[model samples]
Target: MSVPALNRAPDAVTTRVTAPGSRRRPDIEGLRAVAALLIAVYHIWFGTVSGGVDVFLLLTGFLITGSLVRAMERDGRVDLAAFWTKLVKRLFPAGAVVLGAVLLMAYAYFPRSQWTTVIDDVWAAALYYGNWHLALGSVDYMAENSAASPVQHFWSLAVQGQFYLLWPLLVCGAALLAVRLGRSARRGAAVAVGTVFAVSFGYSLWITATAPVWAYFDTGARLWELALGGLLALFVHRVDLPGWARTVAGWAGLAALVLCGLVIGDSLPYPGYASLWPTLAALLIILAGAGTAANGRLSANRLLGARPLTWLGGHAYTLFLWHWPVLVLHLELTGLERPTPGGGLLVLGVSFAAALATSWMVDGGVSRATRRLRTPAWSLAAGVLFVVPVLVAGSLWAQSIERDRQLRTELSSNPLAYPGAAVHLDQDLARNLPSLPVYPDTTTVARDTIDQTRACNALIDQTEVVTCEFGDPRSDYTIALVGSSHVRHWFQALETLADQHGWRLVTMTKNACQFSSGEQRYRGEVFTECAQWNDGVMAALDELEPDTVFTLASLTSVRSGPEEHVPEGFVERWRQLDARGIDVVAVRDTPRFSFRVPDCTDRNHRSECSEPASHSMAERAPYLELDDVPANTRFLDMTGYLCQDDVCHGVIGNQLVYYDTNHFSYSFSQSLAAVMEPYLLEAAGRAPEAELTLAEAALSPEEAAEAAREHDGSS
Candidate 1:
């Protein structure tokens, strides 16, 4: 629920008495109750979009805009300070209480690794920019699999809060312009709002098509819904439809609102043309009920004005605020992806109980205090009282993050502290290793893999091939590290070889984008950027005429099931590169896990976190096809370093293996430099020199002897 709209309803009841032609519509309150219930039910049980949020957005625009216009029409000017003060008093207290509770719950129940995200979200929601934060997160693949934050629902509230702040200023400007131009203030306001609606709607359509994931939480994409509501508010007072027309419109709109969720699944792109169904339906219901008597007739208002709904509506804001966090926390605690019917009902019951207590105790107290205080200064003070605690908590969390960074920096400086995957290869060294919390710690694990020195990985949205040169830049033997981050992570091992073998190493990479010749799908959208980037990469490769192009040969498809296959595009790209006399060295992609390895290892034992290596490597056979393609093509599998006989470990040799779910931790990958050097040399047709083997390179004779002694004792 939009806190301002729901919280202001009681004030509107008193204020409406002085305004002409204004009567309290219990039906709108009832509708709010229905919207809130639908949102809660869909989120907790169905795990789908219910169009309830769109209804709230529409109601927010309609009610707030209507109230502002009525004030302007009666007083001829808007008292912006008084308006803002009232809003702060109405909204802040309940929001602040919820934020404080959520923060405490998070710190107590959530993993330390997730504390930063929760704190960041707390700050964003407090500042009314949570929508942008969520929008950015939606496009990030790494964050896509993260457990839903308890405050994720606050994105809508943030949107509403922003609209609340900006709409009054807009209405005030329109009112002034109308006086200067000798025009109707309401009409001028309608025109201005309509213009904004058009521009926002156009942008929404474009963005939804191009980047629907981001569009889902974008404030710009959502403004049209709010503007539509404002337009209805401006005109509803002037319209006087007959009872029969109202009956038809009311029933149809009610039906549309009820079926919208079932008909338009949550998976579908929304707030574009798809949103018109719900927003327009809501507008119809509001317009149809206007000026209608609430007698026991067949009118929509009469049906909606039932006492129960209005009671729920009275507590809608609190219910909306409390339900999401309750649901998310419940799921996190229970380890259930979704609750059963009984569990969902229990969750809803608890949420409603909490909402009632907060609504009466917290919101009721704030409302009463605001009435007694009345002054802007007291309201400002009340706002500060609400906001200060959350800011203080956020500051403490930020400091903790800085401290973790410092610890990680200190630990990282000692090479012996994190020998990474090398410990698995040398059992002696493994036996002699000191105890340490997995290097890269949960705070830094997300970025533990891949090179940081090079700005060569193009973002998911970019179509350019970012290139960076490493290792023997002037050498005659050129080996281009090309593909997505999977290939980029191998640069640690390959860079070691390049330095040892005198080869020029060039990196061509894009984030989550594989070097495919055909179109690919990313986050359910056509990866036009990836395809375009590949074209650029191919052209660059031709120009550079690199001796060998190292990229991913095969990947496991998570879309359909756990089937491994050589992507048609990868095969096609390989053939093209081979035709250009570029040796295609395809490194088999690593095993991907269903859960985050670092988080799993942090919470559970290594045995509990391990998965069947065979199941993960079921797709390994597809890489064998690379042998049939051409003489220039070479296939390399490094799974031996990553997995054991039957199981794959989250931690190897006292170092965290995977950073997230699939990507290797940088330290782990660096540990594999010795193991991977021989294969890399053979792939590039270079023989190993008189340098030590992987074990010999990393372990001295004394340390090796001590490790052997420990291993013998353990045996």
Candidate 2:
């Protein structure tokens, strides 16, 4: 599920009870405060910043593992039954409170369709399986521009819960092995800590280098951070250092911690070397806090030891529990990416206030109530009371699955009815297209490449890649349009007019086709799919010797100001194509939608679906020239076909021209054939309208085969 290292160390040990009046570790509490604040800021402002969570993981692994190991030494043996019960008691109450509230908020804020996904997540969360679900789905948690699941944040919580389950067992086993070997308790603990740290860190570094995405979210890759913490605890008593050195270390550590949250933005691979800054800082603070009173002056400073911060620090566990759910629910209710600055402060204030109330009320009440639950009946009741509401809320959310599917079907049939909704564009064309137009058989010339005219049927099924041939193969004219969904959208119209003229349209486009010259960011890492696909397309184009290559204007053009640079790779690739004697036609992008495609049809009146939005053609003006290239490359502004007046309507001329957000419908494409016929003739330098006989117009593929069969029968 969570990468194994990121998961709980799957070991169990009894909870440890520290002696009364143990020397106060003010710095550790301060560290906790810092970790909590980093998480809050990152969640509120730069939710993209995940290093904060890494720091938290290090601290959690260190603290809990340390406690469990210490308890194992004192108790002589680790009690698995007591260990699990205590873990449940500590973890489940706070988790249940947060998840229960999140489920309620999801129901209140989300539409029926949105709630189904949320419900599915809630059920996963209840069972501590969120990491498995999210990883399998390849969900991008940092995508603020997209819709979110209410329980999305719970993936981290699930990881921690899994860690708790395993760390204790590992500790117990290590302690037992050491006792058997006649080793001192401290020596045994040290060996256990060192062994785990070495193995886990080695694994983490490799995972961080090789599979950074999995390393980021998976528990296995991250266990080293926790192992580091556990190891630190074993040596806490043995480390002998000067007071000045400890003070210096404490201050330096705090400074390093602050810099990590501030300096580490979204650019770096997280939970890797980037995480070392905060983790090492956390280690320093923990070490500094444990030294004698001489070194404790700064480590146990009056400011850090102050009532309010330490009080929040005391309730940090509870605060972490309540804060995220509250903020998530608040955001859901408002539909804001995150709370505004003022709103963030309000969320912080309200969350802490709620945390305090829950800490005093539910957390304290549950702890007290469960103390009497030593008997099976009372224990069962306590467990059921805690778990049933979460289960039921989760189950209710689950039932919306069928409801969501049915709604999606109805919405796809009529997009105008659902506002702020998105329907699968490929499915729409497959379900709706009535029939294909018939044309006279073109002569089969020895063509090495596909023709554009015959690419119509090929474009319909988008999931699979297909090859087609269009014009007389021997002709010198061949044009290839290569791109992502953006290029595919224009194919229907291009194919229609291609058949009318003799130009072959060689189709080679893929979803998310980034014609990159070098490394590029995609799906949270440097990806090469687009680059590899581009290489293939370029090779095919060179071999075919296409007369012209059509490419989309930069996606950056859609959002950037007129002066903004087009994506460098796109421009460079086109230039490369131009150098090969291919005329480059840079087609400006079509109007993109502000809302989901189905928002136009969503029955809910809360969404904006009435009119499509438009931007200036000036946005595309910069890269249109391509005159610097060797071959003659032209800029075509076909925005006019999709736009009207000042605005681009999703529907054009009373026709649902766009089946979804920006993609033109095939029906719309068929109509545009008339308007584009002139351009096609001009581009190919040929004009030959196909003259279809009545028999040819009416003849089906089956009938043609039948006619051949009849002639054969007569013969």
Candidate 3:
């Protein structure tokens, strides 16, 4: 939500601010205050949206339309340059200030892994494309559980700024066509805005239902809220309500805003049709009191015009800007997920004070100085005062991170320094025992994922069992790696063995999806997408019929605790493989630490980062106890290589072991190749040489048809 000052350029264009008079409405001022404060309160304590952003969008559309339409009507040509320069003056100064503050906070507290992202967001916010940046990150499955960005709240401001850049051109273009056809310019602009509302609203609805997380920050999905506000501005004067009716509508609209936040904040998709609740509520408040007095009896409009609210509304822009970062920073400083009531009040008080001081220094002092000249050039130049410094600082910070990465990459080249799991697996390879520096650089550890090993797993929403082939694709011996991300991480070892032994390797993995015959759940919801993907995997496996099918037979419940078991899904998948006469090499599940291993290792000694290895596995393999298990199924245990003395350490053989909480580091996974080679060879050697073409022929006619259908539908 931008400050109203950004919309309040000189009256040369906005003289027709309302139908009744050029003076601003006190009730609208109060409404702006309510919107800004509601966002702050909801963010601090409720951890849910308050739809205050939707209200702000409506206000901007109404105000911007009034300014532009009036300018075009008076001059016959819209001054796009002047409008842009004025916007720069009113918005950039405050935006730069906030971005600068965020950078300082990030440097002080955020981990080194987060610097690249923070810098990227600062650049995006500075350029007013923050919304797209956020939308893309939201859709990327690897970005899950990321720390909250302080500048994430700038997304709405970016959407508003983008609208400012495009809306005037649209209005001017439509007005010209209208004049050629002898229609009124205002009527033409209204038609154009209405079309935008309808088209954008439809897209919003479709996108919201299909990809709600991405939709929340997508500019296209949010454009309708602003367009709806523009429509209100174009014809607001045509409405004339009785005083008592106006009062009733005004009160109802305000209550509706409060209720909208309470009812649908967490459950429903936003800025689509669901957002009409708050957008229309704002429209009601505007329409009810448009160009009217608030002096009637039993007046909701009069209540809105209370002195304190109107005064606070004057500072709404800066208040909104300051509150979010302040809340996020306070939470970081306190190590609290959310602030207590006293802490919330403390955060609010500090944000209010900062807003006041910033307003005085920039809005009052620098603004008064800029107003003396009042030229477009001066406004732009003055607004750029803080922007240049932010860009320079961000550039320096990014370069420093890259420099540190280069240094680490060069130092990690020595095999003796980072032998990974080799020191334990191979006793002959001698080096300084436990005194070596950790490798893969824990500062940049999150990137040390299976993607670095294979770059081939599907995202969570993906249902296609896409295959990534490595090593000798023409080799007669084929090994199929299938399962969730846990198994995907083992590709570092599999790919190494494939290269050395001249065997073909194919990986079919989904991020959190296990190749299961039974029902699978992700985040406690029925994983229908994974179920669909599993069917595709079965079809593909039928066509490939590899000598040995390699997958996980055990599961580690990462969220609950460090505990391992052979799931029914694992047994079910192996059972189908058994029916096909394919050999199985099921590896025991890896230990998944409940805490961030890299984070712990970064700040503590190796001893402090160790977890009891007993927590990961039972005294005996759980799969061995199951009745009616596949006779051809074989088990592989590398627990001795990963754990020693009943302990699993964060850093193994001088290499960081895990990137996130559960997944293995690419380097550590590669280190297990030598130890795992013998077990894989034994399973593949005993398997019968069954041609895949014959396996396909063995499928029933109905099964073949279904497999063909699945292949056609896969991505």
Candidate 4:
């Protein structure tokens, strides 16, 4: 399973070691160093989670809560403005530096298609809402093919920033309520914090069970981890363990802290019960050092306080900020998904250097320069200097991407200039691709790939069948295409044919769902939503009673391995259509690849990305092997046209075929319209019309423009 991209811990709100009344806890600071290192190591070597993020959350809760409680006792109220001033000044300078650097690196190293995501993430990270942004994207099926954002690791910082904003307010409320009830403010706050811990923890368990991907980045689901640390803070001063007991407990907790990531990796559900291993381990270490004076021989206090670890701890904020981006930059620069051990070391070394330099600029230069003018207002102003330039650059870069999309939109108008798949179909149109520019260039191919059925299709959650009609909608001759996204993406081809044949085109599709009732699973859970959608599609077909029902009779599974077969449910559906005297076009399912075609084509010549015919599908269509075929169901296999001579080219006739790993590009579908015309017409129980000349058969310039305009989304 692909783990969610939330694999790192974050910095605390501030790097101030000693609060007004509290002494520095170098051990906890060094734990921050441990957390930061665990994240980097686990990510680069294990390719999984390390629970380091939970440790960071626990540390933030303990330190920040302790600071706030002390202030409440001393000042007689929670100092909101003072806390905010210190946080914005101390935290954002280094954060802004990282975001700016990521933006520049993304522009240089990342693909243009990824620029939009980087632009959004840069602003979101700058404004402290990146966690929510990532939470939403985690469940977006369309974003499944995307590469990790350079600044994606900033989500943990965003979560901490949000907590810092709300923690003070919650404690203040608890303090006010305590005064009204004649109770100690500290005890009252502890009670409130415990309540938050319980509720958030319960919600975390439920969300992780049902939607683990979204749960991983959810601030609400993670709030309890921080609150647990808050509870530890309120009670730590009272833990009066014997010195020997403290030493033993401290070492045990340290061992457990390192073990949590390795033993309970991301293969298990996280920020839930599994997260307790790391959170409680961090709390135990902090508790062991509660009355810190001298370090024990093997205690966490001594181990974490090694001079180098302490230094990394002091600068953990910038180290956390720089490590993931540095690692991702290495991957983007080289086309490798994961680095070699030596490469990982290089990434870490670069991360350490960048972190130290960034820390010096933020801590030494900025703090020193502002020392004389070190008012709350001055800190806020200085932080803004780091943030505004990045936002401005993001806005300008976003505008440039839009212009690139607009220019590419014109490529569809001149067919001769970029004939796409037509070059493969017609002898006169055949041309070498090397000289002609690929329309919908690699820079914007992702945009060109549209949800062709969004106007008619159901979302993953939507059970009600939705339909959209196109191409001579009022015509008596009609065709209804029903199935999964494969059928949806084929709409351009069907639409082109319907326009020529003067037939109404109806599409019924749901993402990740085929017209089957065999009880499939989506994201490792029973796909009840898809099952319900199939039933609804059946009902809709009965009501419309179109001349023919078009669907994929065979299917391919990229996960199950490279082979094609007919699902029993597909045969049942075809038989039902046949029983109703509805003619059917059971188009053979297409091959799905393991890599995103656009990304591969961007870095390599398009032809170099081709897969072998054996990997594309089974030797022939599986439905043809059936003992008894449904009478009215005519199967259409275009594998011959798609793959020839034991090789499936990624680019054919100067046109890229698949948009993502599985789906066809809209232009490629249009190019296939004429090729599939005879079988589709036969499926609709209509005789073929006289063939037109290649020039006459092609979509007119006006029709091409119309097809482009009719495509979904702003692009």
| RMSD to true structure for each model, in Å | 4.1, 11.9, 9.5, 6.4
Write down the TM-score of every candidate.
0.91, 0.68, 0.88, 0.90
Model 3, 421-506: lDDT tens digits are 65543333322343555667655666546346335777777888789888898999999999888788889899998998899999
Better of 1 and 3 by TM-score: 1
Q: How many steric clashes between backbone atoms does each model show?
A: 0, 41, 0, 0
Q: Give candidate 3 misplaced runs (Cα > 4 Å).
A: 1-5, 8-23, 295-298, 426-437, 448-455, 523-525, 559-564, 603-607, 610-621, 639-648, 686-715
The clash number for model 3 is: 0
lDDT for 624 in candidate 4 is 78
lDDT of each: 0.76, 0.56, 0.76, 0.76
Candidate 1 on 384-465: residue-level lDDT in tens?
6888898898788779877976787688667665677566556546686665676666656564443363356787788987
Give candidate 3's whole-model lDDT.
Answer: 0.76
Worst 10 residues of 3 by lDDT: 8-17
Candidate 4 weakest ten by summed lDDT: 1-10
Q: Put the candidates in TM-score order, highest first.
A: 1, 4, 3, 2
lDDT of 2 by residue, 1-715 (tens): 0110111111112122111114545445555666777677777766656355666677676666666565666667655555555555555666677677777776665544345456667777777888777654442221122345656766776787677777767777777788889886656766777787788777778876765656666776677787787777676766656787677777887777767766877667666777788888777766665655544544533345556665656566656666676777677566677788888887788778877776676546876776766643544455457667888867765665445545544544442332111111122322232321110000111010123223422221123434456556665677776766566666766776566566678777765554446555555555555566667677777788888776776553244444333576876776787678677766666666654333243323311233433342443445655455444555665554444333454443223445444555544555555455545555555544452132123323243334323432443
Minimum summed lDDT over a 10-residue window in model 1 is located at: 11-20
lDDT of 4 by residue, 1-715 (tens): 1111111124454444432236566677788889889988888777778878888888778767777677666666755765676677777788889999988888787765566778888999999999899887776565577788788888888889899789989987897788679988888889999999999999999988877888889999999999988888888877757788888878888889898778998668877788889888887788777764566776777788788888778767777788899999998887788999899999989998999898888778987788676556876787787788988998988888778767766865677656665654444444222334455666556555653444577767678988888989689987998988888778889899989889999989878898886887787778998999999888888999899888898887664563688888888888888888788888888877777777777667665667765665777678879987888888887665566565665665557787778788877888788677766655565653554243345444344333333331222
